[model samples]
Target chain A: MKTFFTTGKGICIVGIGIGITAALLQKLGNPPNMGVCVACFVRDITGALGFHRAGVVQYIRPEIIGFVLGAFASALISKEYRPRTGSAPIVRFLLGFFAMIGALVFLGCPWRALLRLAGGDGNALLGLAGLVLGIGIGLYFIKSGFNLGRSQKTYFSVGLVMPVIAVGLLLLLITRPELKTGALFLSTKGPGALHAPLLISLAAGLLIGFFAQKTRFCTMGAVRDAMLIRDFHLMKGVIGLLAGAFLTNLIVQQFNPGFTGQPAAHSVHFWNFAGMLLAGLAFALAGGCPGRQLFMSGEGDGDAAVFVCGMVAGAAFAHNFAIAASPKGIGPLTPLFVGIGLVTCVVIGFTMRKKI
Target chain B: MMPDRIDARGLSCPQPVVMTRNKMDTSKSCSFEVLVDSGAARDNICRMATGMGWDVQVTEDADECILVLSKK
Candidate 1:
């Protein structure tokens, strides 16, 4: 097969797709500044699975399923599908968990952070700052040689693991599996209950996944590249996405600007920045943002897959225990979780480095 | 002037820009053709090109785009 799309190209294209898709979603009736948020969607999925019982945020998002399956398809076609594991799997899992915590605290992911800004959410300014700070910290680790140990290529089945899990979840979603009398694990209402047509969401995801697989777009990486290397290649794609979305939103009359009353966002500039800072640091340390992580997981990276699972679990824990922040303020347990997440990230940075 | 066109078409967000920058420093007056499938990449690349003082012309070819730039 011929491979024309490199990793960087894939990210740019995928970012564009996401930008377009988000605008479409808003036009088609989803919330503003929230066309596609992997973290928020996953949080809703967690609620759908009855993990969080947050009545307002539960739903089985088909777009997520499409993200994984689409990535899997692309990986398979590109012959880049290499399943591997065993580099501090548990620690990676914990990092994934805390990463979500940080994102929830800020109310957005790296992609969403950028999207928020494009849509005129001034709160994103602080979030973007925080994201940069967080990634800067992670860069320090990289500079100091904080390695997660190289992943050894494992059995092909290892990579298939996430796809299988995704398929099972799909089945459950379709069948409404009655594992318990009144607890079948599905979102009936709230943000989780909201959905675009499954086929539409799935098709969009698959197309994005395929393109993302081809291009390898990452929001965190875009900022990281610009900051660390004075490079703007990936940042260019991000600009494209923002520009596309901005135009689309303006055309569609969805370009609502402000720090307050933004859909699925809060006005806490410090936390917004801090939350994304933590998330950015985590993505930098882990080598990708949540969206990129999902794509990697689909491509048979067990570590990435573990990270996705960790995000889902983290979302569950956040809502179940009141750790995820809302539009009003930090959730009941966010302070503790954020503290732990920050400490853990710091510890990982300090300890996991080679003394040059 | 080696007219090198970095087909950042299928690549992700930062990689194209990263690759472009990497190539830019070495090449003088070369045409860097950046093909992006999304408007986002195209716009960002265009802005960056303008900011860098490159003569940029964008042509759309069926959703995929080509940004031709002559370096200063």
Candidate 2:
């Protein structure tokens, strides 16, 4: 069960498993295609922490916590836990920050983009296109000599930071402590209010975390590889995800296709494209997608830890600044933030190059 | 003649393979060497190059891998 399955077929199986699990989660009461949205869950966690006062978006999700702990356990079991750090960590943090901003602007991550498509949400097509373009731009930078530099071996304890935090969060979720400071918020009437059973969410997250870690499942990497090398191994995994999710959705009779009135999604085509463009570029720059970052953090990469923290912080900032989108439309400052994120990503892409 | 060398150390997976593919895309340069630091990169390059009708010979040197791809 805890084996490193990095082969093409192995990754495809993992993808299908993730897709089915996510569909089931949605049916069980997650926010639509948000069954496994890394970005949205991080955003919800920030709200629960009282980082932003978004009433309808506050909840400590067990799935997020499970993702970290599960990957940590998997890496430990597989003897692949390599505690390492020091490769432009600050840059990675900023990349993750902008990545969250972009995801919220689009109202989802690449995973959600795929899940949304599988759920028969037509808007996901634009987001997927934007993701491809974004990765393409990032690949251009990569081809023109961009590197995050090399990381060094670090002490074992350093890598355990994210897992410790995960455990702490899980405890908070379980205890549901009533702090005097009005923390540990939960939404009574929004996407944050909807969730699958705690055990189920946690189990699905654990399975996803374990498999993703073993296979190195990354949505951005899938698109990048397909485009850059004309190799479709990772792309096969993406196809598997879509197929699995679609099949599950059909079985549940939850397939609904249209541009308008999609759950937790907006019809603003421009922002959808630009938002994911920024997110995709950020993930590419950071060397992994959001889920991959969490998995790496579990395995003891301090840089990945920093990136994950940046994402959490960015979620807070997004909601606080009113830059995150809602079903109604784009946030007022979304264009500003998305534009800034795009420019920042481009600058990072251009400036962080090693001499070829 | 010394084969063209592309040092992909520190770059993530598929980048190594992508760069190697770029080199192969040019008809004039059929043989090249890639310096990658991870087993994943080495394996990916081997897998991709082998699929592209190129032979990959991997040699290890001090925390890095040298993947030499040749068409002839």
Candidate 3:
């Protein structure tokens, strides 16, 4: 029969996996510990489309599209497509928006933070610690009857929104709109500007999405489950992903161990921690990470779709307003925005909690 | 008479197992292959295969893995 393990195994596995994914990403020609970064890539995509003029960090990552479409396809084939909605939708959106902001400030999400550590960036340690603290705070709220309300079953069309949006983005990607004639946006330079070939990127995204959905693989959920239920079943998958990537990286000879001048990384320790702290807390409070949220959104969660949209908007805002950080350091407005986000998260946490 | 294939590549864990269960009921002499890229996926697939009374063999590739299962 089916058996469940303790959370420790899962955590250790995730640690090892992060290390592995770091090496693999480097091997695959991705910046160290950046095999897949949701926030950064989105930001890069934003910049590529001329959302902001930030250079030196623009590239369209196939992994992003792969994550959602993969999940979409998997959920469909496996019959896990249960469309649902109505769970403090606006609040979740705001959380996603701020979570993106925080991640941009740190220049990575929790996943990237771990990868950064694996790639020898000490500054990532601060971000990781901040993530833990943020999650810890969220746990306190969760323990104290904090909830964002319950989600209810909704129409099938509601669930299709995420996948549809992803497909739209893909089509636009292929069509390549011309701005002079006034069409959809596209990045020309910087991190947003960089992209792997379209087909390769889409295929990768589809594959990962399928696997993740089938396994119910979720990094944030893995950590949250360990902390809350003391369970590790989900955690093992995270570990496996990391290990797979790491082994691949080693085979490809991309292991670089140390903290300074890592590609697409910065040295600001405090913000790294603080930024992830905000993201972790938001994720914990929202009940999923950015990646997980994308999967959920794809599987017919209108609320999650809202959150995903929030992330998109947040990315736009981060860049448009210069609140996002760069390799040089935290952007001027990032700290203030993060502060506001934390306060807002706490306020929502307290106000929306179910009284059970 | 229909040979069933479970393309579980990119699927995480319990998902492949769950889908396998769903797929097994639809076919006789079920021959299935689960695709994955991680050891955990392989492990879970094998465990489920055994529990379901299916014979399983695992094969690995550079960035992909396959778990072939047949009802015993």
Candidate 2 residue lDDT tens string, B1-72: 334898777666556766777678863776788888755577678768888788888898645778888995
User: Per-residue lDDT tens digits of candidate 2, residues A27-126?
Assistant: 9999987878999999999999899888999998888888888899988986667777898899999999999999998899999999999998999998
Order by lDDT, highest first: 2, 1, 3
Which window of 10 residues has the lowest lDDT sum in candidate 2 chain A? A1-10
Identify the leading candidate in terms of TM-score: 2
Number of clashing pairs per prediction, in order: 32, 0, 34
What's the best-to-worst order under DockQ? 2, 1, 3
Q: State each model's CA lDDT, in order.
A: 0.74, 0.86, 0.69
Candidate 3 docking category? incorrect
Candidate scoring better on lDDT of 2 and 3: 2
What residue runs in model 3 are displaced by over 4 Å at the alpha carbon? A1-32, A48-60, A181-185, B1-72
Residue A155 alpha-carbon offset, candidate 2, angstroms? 1.2
Model 1: lDDT to the true structure = 0.74
Q: Candidate 1, which CAPRI tier?
A: incorrect
TM-score pick, better of 2 and 3? 2
The Cα error of candidate 3 at residue A186, in Å, is 3.9
